[model samples]
Target: MASKNRKPPRVGDQPGFRRALIAAVLVVTAIFIVAPLVVIGVQAFSQGWAVYATAIADPDTLHAILLTVTTALIAVPINTAFGVAAAWAITKFDFWGRRFLLVVIEIPFSISPIVAGVAYLFVYGLQGLFGPALQSADIKILFALPGIVLASMFVTAPFVARELIPLMQAQGRDLEEAATSLGASGWRTFFSVTLPNIRWALLYGVVLCNARVMGEFGAVSVVSGNIRGQTNTLPLHIELLYHDYQTAGAFAAASILAVLAVVTLVAKVLLERRGAGRGGRPTLAANQTVPETTT
Candidate 1:
C-alpha cells in the first residue's frame, strides 16, 4: 500500500479557537480605551445640547478654551524645534555625556507632574528662590501665562524627540550625504533630504504633544492657581464645573476635548497611512535621483 500524505495546516485550521481568542482581546481592549469616551458622550448629548450650550456659553469656559489653544499653539512649536534639535544631536553626532543627556531628556516623563509643578513653584513662585530676582525685574512666572506654557513644554518635550530619534537613526545619513555631494547646501540638504524622511514622525509627535498639553491637569493646576477666566484652562475649567455640581457642563467640556482627541487620532492614522504608502514605494533612483521635493 502506498503511504498516505496529510495536508499542511492552514492558518484558519483552528478557526473557532482563534476567532474566540481574538474577539475576547478586541472586546477587552475596546472597553478599556473607549468606555469612558462613550460615557462622556452620552452625558454630553443626553440633555439635547442644552448642557453643551450652557458650558460653551460660560465666559470662563470660553476663556479657558482660548488659553488652552493659545498655550498649545505656542508650546507645541517650541517643543517640536527642541525635539528636532535634540534628536539631531543624539543621533547625528557622538559626544561626551551623550548617553547622560538622553537620560536627562526623559526626566520629565519619570517625574510626577505634581512634582514638576512644585519644582517650578520653588523657582518661580512668590517667595521662591528666584522670586526676589523676578520681582526686582517686574517679571512674573508662577500663577502666570509663562508658567503655564513652561509646564506644558516640559511635559510634551519628550514626545517628538522620542519619535524622531529612532526614525533618524534607522534612516541613516545616506540621503543627506548624497544631497551634499550633489551641490546642495547644508540647509538645502536638510530641508530637501532630512525633513522629508522624518516628517511623518515629526507630525505624529506634534499631534501627541498637542494632545498631552491640552489634557494636562496636575502640573498646570498646581501653577495655574485655577483662577477663573484668567489662569483656568479647559481641563481646569472642567474641574471647576465638576466641583460646582455642574455634571452635565463638565461632561460637555470634556466631550469637546474627547472629540478633539478623536480627530487627532484619526488624522494621525491617515497621515501614518500616507507615510507608509510613500515608504513602500520604490525611489526613482537607487544611486542619486532627485525626487520631487515636497513643501
Candidate 2:
C-alpha cells in the first residue's frame, strides 16, 4: 500500500503513462508519415512492372529527372560554398554590419518561396527592371533553366549556412588563431585545421541542401513556367501527371523523390550518429592519444 502511494523518481517514470505516450506517438507517425509512404509505394507499382517501367521511361519524366538533377548539381555546390563562407565570416571575424549580414543570410528562411519566385520574375522578367536590357542583350533569365536554378538557389540558400553556423560558433577560433600564429597561411589553416573539424557538419548541410534542391516545388514552379518536356522539373512534372489523371505515372515519379528522401534521411541519421546535425558537434579522431607524464 505504501509503495503504491509513493511517487516514481521521475515525472514520466510511470509504466502506464510511458506506454500511453509511446502508443500515441506511434499512432500519429503511422497515420501521417508511414501511411503515405506505403500508399506511394503501393500505387507506384499498382499497374504492374510494365506500366511502372513505361512511366519511368517516358520522355517527359526522363526530362524532368534530368532537369532536377541538373538543378541540384548546380545549386548544391554553390550554396555549400556560400554557406561555408558565410559561416566562416560570421563566426571567425568581427566587422561592420556583421549582424546585418547574418540577418540577410537568413531572410530566405523567413520569406515564402513563392514570394521569392515572384520577386525574381519582377527583377528579370520581360516587364521587369532589367527586362529590356536583357532582351536587347539576347539574355534569357526568366521561364528558363537559369530562372529555375536561381529560384531553387534562393529557396535553399539558408540550409547549409544554418547547419554550419551553430557548429562553427561552438567550435570557436582558437585553432585557427593558433595556426595563424604558427605561420600557417589562411588557405592552409582552413584546409588543415578548419576543414577536418567541420567536414561532417558540412556534409550534413550539403545533404540537406541537395535534398531540398531536388524536392523544391513552389519557387521552381513559378519560375519554370511548367513547359512540360522542356522546363518542367520532377515536382512540376508530377503535378502535371496527377492533374491529367495519370495516377500511376505520378506515383512512379513521386517514388523517385521518395527514394531520394529516404537516402537523404539515412545519410542524415548516419551523420548525426557521427556527431553532426542540429546542435551536434564532431567527435575527435580515434587515433589521438594523450601525452604521458612523470610525477
Candidate 3:
C-alpha cells in the first residue's frame, strides 16, 4: 500500500513572518541612528588631515579635550560607587520611604542638565544661597572647575544604579547566602561573590556614564562660563568653534567625540557578547538516571 502524502511546510510558515518583520525594523533603526554619525565623520575628514591637525593642535581645543578627560575620570568613579551603594541599599534592604528615595535618585536623569546646572547655581552661584558664605571663603563655583565636575556628577549618577538594580534582583540572594553560611564575613561575601557577579553590569554603566560626561554640553555651558582654555570641555570647545564660524574645526572636534562614543559602544557590545556566552553554558542536572536493572 502507498503511504499518504503530506504537504511540505511553506517557507512563510510558523513565526518566520514575525522574525522577518523584526529584522526589517532593526535594519531601519540602525540606518536612522548611524546616518548622522556617518555624516559627521565624512565632514571631519573631508577637509584633509591638515584641517584635523590644525583643529587639534590649537591650544584652546587641546585644553578643552584635556579638561573633558579629566572631568570624566573624576566623575565616573564617584558616580559608580554611589550607584552601587544606592542599588544595594534600595534593593537589598527594607526601609521606610525606599520607593521615594529611588524616585529621588532617578530625578536627575529625568531633569534637563541645564536645569540641574541652574539648580546648582541657585545654591552655589554668586547670588545663590551659599553665595555669601562662598564669597567670604573666596570660593567660586559658577564659571569654575568645581561647577563643571558637580554638574557632570549630577547627570551621570543614575546610570550604574539603573543597570544594577535589575541585575541584582534577577540574580537573587542564594549565592550571597551561601557565602555567608560558609562563615564568610559580610564584607568578604560582598567583595568575593557579589562584586564579581555585578562587575560587568557596573562596567557597562560606567562606559555609558563616561560617554555622557564627555559629551555633556547644556549643563557645562551654564557653569563653565565658556572660559576658553579655563573651564572649557570638548563639547564646549566644539560650540565655541561653531560660533566662531570654524565649521571644519567644529566637525573635527565632534569627530573625536564620535570616535570615543564608537569605542565605548564597541566595548559594550563585546562585553555583552561575552556575558551572554557565559550565561548560555549549561549546568549539570541534580538528578541522574541509574542503569537498567533488566538486561
Candidate 4:
C-alpha cells in the first residue's frame, strides 16, 4: 500500500550505474556517428558559400546528380511493382521451394556490391553469352546506362518485398476475404483492403531502397566506366573531384548524399514513432492507418 502511494520513478532518478552506462553510450555515438556527420558538414562548406555553390553547380556535378536521380527513377518503380507482386505471392500462398525463393531474393543483402558488378560484366561483357549478339546489333549493356540500372535494381530488389512479406503474412487473409466476400474484385480488394494496411511499411521500404539506389557506388562504379559527365553518378563524381585535388568540391558533392541519409533516418524515426502510438485507438492505429489485410 505504501509503495503504491509513492510517486513513480523519473528518468533522472535512474541508478548511478544505469546513468553511467547511458552516458557511455552517448559518448561513443557522438564520437563515431555524430563526429563524421559534423566533419562532412564542416568540410562541405569549408571553402565558403560561393565556392561550395560553384562546386555543386558545375556541369559535371549537375550531370552526375541527374544520372543518379534518373537511375533511381528507373530502378525504383520496377522494383516497387515487383516487390508488391512478390510479397503478395510469397505470403498469401504456400508452395514448394518458397523458402528457397526467399533466400534467392535476399541474395543481394549477403553479397558484396563489387561482386555483383563483376557478375554483370561477365554476363554482359564482350566475351559473354549474349554479348556477341548484342554487340552485332550495337546494343550496349556493359559500362552503360542499362548496366547501371540493372545493377541498382539487383542491389535494391529485396528491400520492399522484404518489408512487406513478413508484415502481410502476420496480417493474414481475414480482411482480404472479408472484402472479397463483400463483392470487392481482386483489384478492389488490393486497393481498398490491402494497400492501406501496409502503405507505411511499403513507403518505408521504398525510402530505404531509394537511398541505396542513390548511394550505390561499387556496382555502379564497375558498370559506369566513370565517363566524366556521361555515366558518372554522384559518388563516382565525388571520387573524381577528390582525386583531381578538388577538396571542397568532393566534400560538397558528399554533402548531398549525406543530407539524403539524414532525411531517410528522420523519416524512419517518424514512422517508427507513429507505429508505436496507441492513444484511444486500436493499438496498431497509433500512427497506423486502417486495419491491415493480407493479399
- In candidate 2, position 121 carries an lDDT of 89
Error of 4 at 242 (Å): 1.3
Cα RMSD, model 3: 9.5
Worst 10 residues of 2 by lDDT: 284-293
In model 3, where do residues sit more than 4 Å from their true spots? Answer: 1-31, 275-295
Please, what are the lDDT tens digits per residue for candidate 2 over residues 108-172?
A: 77778899988998999887899889999999888889999999999888788777777877788
- Model 1, 1-295: lDDT tens per residue? 2332265456665778788989999999889987888999998888887667987888988899999999999899999999999978776776677656766776677778999899889888876789889988999787878999999988776777777776776676788778889999988987888998888888888888899999999899999988999999999999999999888888888987998999888977887785622332222111111122223
Instruction: Assess candidate 1 and give its TM-score to the true structure.
Output: 0.85
Query: In candidate 2, which residue ranges exceed 4 Å CA deviation?
Result: 1-9, 280-295
| By TM-score: ranked, best first | 2, 4, 1, 3
- List CA RMSD, all candidates: 7.7, 7.3, 9.5, 5.9
Better candidate by lDDT, 2 or 3: 2
Quote model 3's TM-score. 0.83
Over the stretch 106-203, how does candidate 3's per-residue lDDT look in tens digits? 67777888898888888898779998899899988778888899999998777777777667756767898899999999999889999998888878
Deviation from native of the Cα of residue 146 in model 2, angstroms: 0.7
Give each model a TM-score: 0.85, 0.91, 0.83, 0.88
Model 4 misplaced regions, further than 4 Å? 1-14, 276-295
Return the lDDT, model 4, position 58: 99
For TM-score, the strongest prediction is: 2
